[model samples]
Target: MKVLRRWTAALSALSLLVVALPASAAPATRWEPCPVAGSAERQECATLTVPLDHRDPHGRKIDLRISRIPAKGTSRGALVIIPGGPGNSGLNRPSTVNFPAEIRESFDLIGFDPRGVGQSSPVSCGMAAADARRLTPWPGPDGDISENIATAKRMSEACARNGGDVLRHISTRNEARDIDEIRKALGRSKISYWGLSYGTYVGATYATLFPQRTDRVVLDSSDDPDPRRVARGWLANYAVGFEDRFPDFARWAADPANPLRLADSPDAVRPLFLDLAAKLDRAPQDWPGAVPPKLNGNALRETLLRGLSTDAGFPLLARTMAAARDGSPAPVPVLPPDAVLQNISAVAAATICQDVTWPRDIDRIARDVQRNRARYPLTAGMPANAGICSSWPHQPAERPVEVTSHGPANVLLVQNRRDVATPLSGAWKLREAFGRRAVMVTVDAGGHGSYLATGNACGDTTVTKYLLGGARPAHDLHC
Candidate 1:
């Protein structure tokens, strides 16, 4: 990822009160057991009743599905796992992600499906399955976004027409409010949080709005929260991210002894992959049983970019590239199951469009596409173009909260040097915004999800220290 480093002084003037909150009021409704399919012994589930709209708290309510794994020892506080995807469900994460035993001993590990996601009152734009499948317009061979614009318009219109009133409320500000409600429901005055990917934004928003209620915050794979350019900034970041991380893939693919090696030399791999993508663009090769079944340029590029998100996915890219080059049809990884896809699409679009205003002018997007294509050929121009936000029907529910240094000095950001999803360049923007309120641990590794997944000991230790004990490094640390 492109590393854009900047720093600023911390703001400490805001005299926020850290008052003890009262116990949760007895709900007019009763709670129910919302259990996962298996692993019933280690975890327990419950539903928390929160208002559909915080402004009208006494009005209609929605149920937020929450899961908890009690601490082994006396608990210091509760640690909430804020899952990413804006649409992801954290209800199952505690068991799957293997919550740290030491941290779990000191705190009750909590996870939940955010409002309008998962077991929480889910919302769908009600798009036709076929339309929804084709809605994500993969950019053309030359990086033209004319088709993407059309797709965005159609998608936005479909969502507006079919999505109910709940769809209008799927913004990040609302999600933050939902977090506050969750806190109230959990009977905690302050909470420690672990947020990943877009969850980092939600966690930051919570800290910004209710800093006094935040005991500790760990923003992993941090994202730039510049309100003026939200997802636009995220999209543009891929240009730099792909450039930074692609070399790692190249080195892996070029290693001679590696069974999945695609090229003889690291330098030769990039152009070779590019050539294959271009060849497929002109004449798509058939892949049996794969969705759409044809290997097109955008599909190849999307596959490559998605694979770069983590180390586990590296060999998949290498194998796919090798097969494509040999003219043998390679199987595409199965897309997430339909229910999962629907939930994720809804949350991703809602959080992104809710957080900021997108440029409505097609000419602006056309210009961006032209520039991004010229600068970064690997991702083509998809990273620079507009998404469903371009045609969103409703205005953003609230102004995007500017993440400032006004909060407590309890945030610790961990980032990988080359993260394709949330790149180092964006991480710097976040670091600048947080000022002295945060100390970033920049790992010398590649891929996303820095602390546990990136395989960097220094970065992991820095974050673990902060989480287990309230310790902060004297200055910004580079590992």
Candidate 2:
């Protein structure tokens, strides 16, 4: 969701005009087994050499790392999983997230690290850890953004000084081109895709660029497709998302049966959280081992936001909220391994900065911060402010591609009603953009990922039916 804006710019440009890259079947450059432990049998790795600049197909090349998990039985087609971060590498998907056996047996699962991410030709803005930490300020007290502007400037300077030529090429349009090249390299006339979060943007770009080449495409947690307000729009949506999803957390926290309960009832939970956050904002508490050094209002909010990504994360939110209410600062939860965080952050930044040109006008952001802070106190002003993209040097190489009914009617969009990240409102907008070309399933559940992560039987069954039997709902359906 945070990364959606960058791709939105690329998609917008694409929608305004069409830039064609000739399609050609190319041979794989280098093929090897993935080195990640426990992935040897299920995953194989390869390098795909594509032109650094698509306009000059015969020019210098950049390599994309590709991974595949072969189908157990006969294959229906190859299902490519596009990782969300413009910077996210899909190279390890074969070993991480579990795939339904039926789908796995029918399709070869493919994943790739988009250029400048993961095992592909990696790029770094070379930001110091300290400077990078400050780049995105936690939403300020009352959602003010005076601090965010300063952070944006510092981050931009670090990138301008350290990010090399590769950073300039990290736009979403280029990534779409990279996907087409991957398709050609794989010898597939059409490709199936399951894109999550920012991956939805990539999938949309591919569909726009090569509609004939798209097979079964599922965009989970869909985003606002408007090019002009890509990431910016997403940031604002946190206000509604938090409002919609927080009730779930509140319900769990206030339940008497739950050991993690923090309030007498769900109605009491919201105020409790708001009060604690305000208390923390006035007096920062020490929590050793937490990132950013101490437990503060913004950190608590960040945790709450991250926790809303999945249902399993609800407990953490409850526990954290409970501890905070008791006045005993809890340690920041351990994150994934450092290497994983490094890779994730790298991919996220590259994709975001490359996709769009953030507003250079600090005043506009400041105003937005003020407005957002007033309306969405929970997220503060952090969601509305500029990120590394504000300081990004280059304009998007290509505009965002508009998704329309021009493509084949092969897309299935599944969304949770209360997703804190992507949010339901954005998903509705995506469905509208697709027009009659898509059928959406709105699940009566919460959290980010919907089809699998949301525990709604109807929602999962509907998606599974489509994926396995190519059956789509008659119209936009609700479960």
Clashes of 1: 0
Candidate with the greatest TM-score versus the true structure: 1
User: Candidate 1, residues 336-376: lDDT per residue as tens digits?
Assistant: 77666766776677778877888889888888888878888
Quick one: best lDDT, which candidate? 1
Q: Model 2: per-residue lDDT, tens digit, 1-479?
A: 01111222333344323223211212332345665676444576777677778877767677777877777887777788888754566888866766777887887778888877866778666555654544345656765665666666666665667666666677667888898776665556678888888888788778888889888889888888778777667766878899889998888877889887788888998888888889889887887777667677877887898888777888877777766777676847876554555445555665666565567787787787888777877877777786766766567776666778797889899898999988899989888888877999999898888866767889888887887778799988999
* lDDT (Cα) of model 1: 0.77
Worst 10 residues of 1 by lDDT: 3-12
User: What clash count goes with each model?
Assistant: 0, 12
What local lDDT does model 1 show for residue 458?
A: 87
Which regions of candidate 1 are displaced past 4 Å?
1-41, 130-137
Q: Each candidate's lDDT (Cα)?
A: 0.77, 0.74
Q: Kindly give the stretch of ten consecutive residues in candidate 2 with the minimal lDDT sum.
A: 1-10
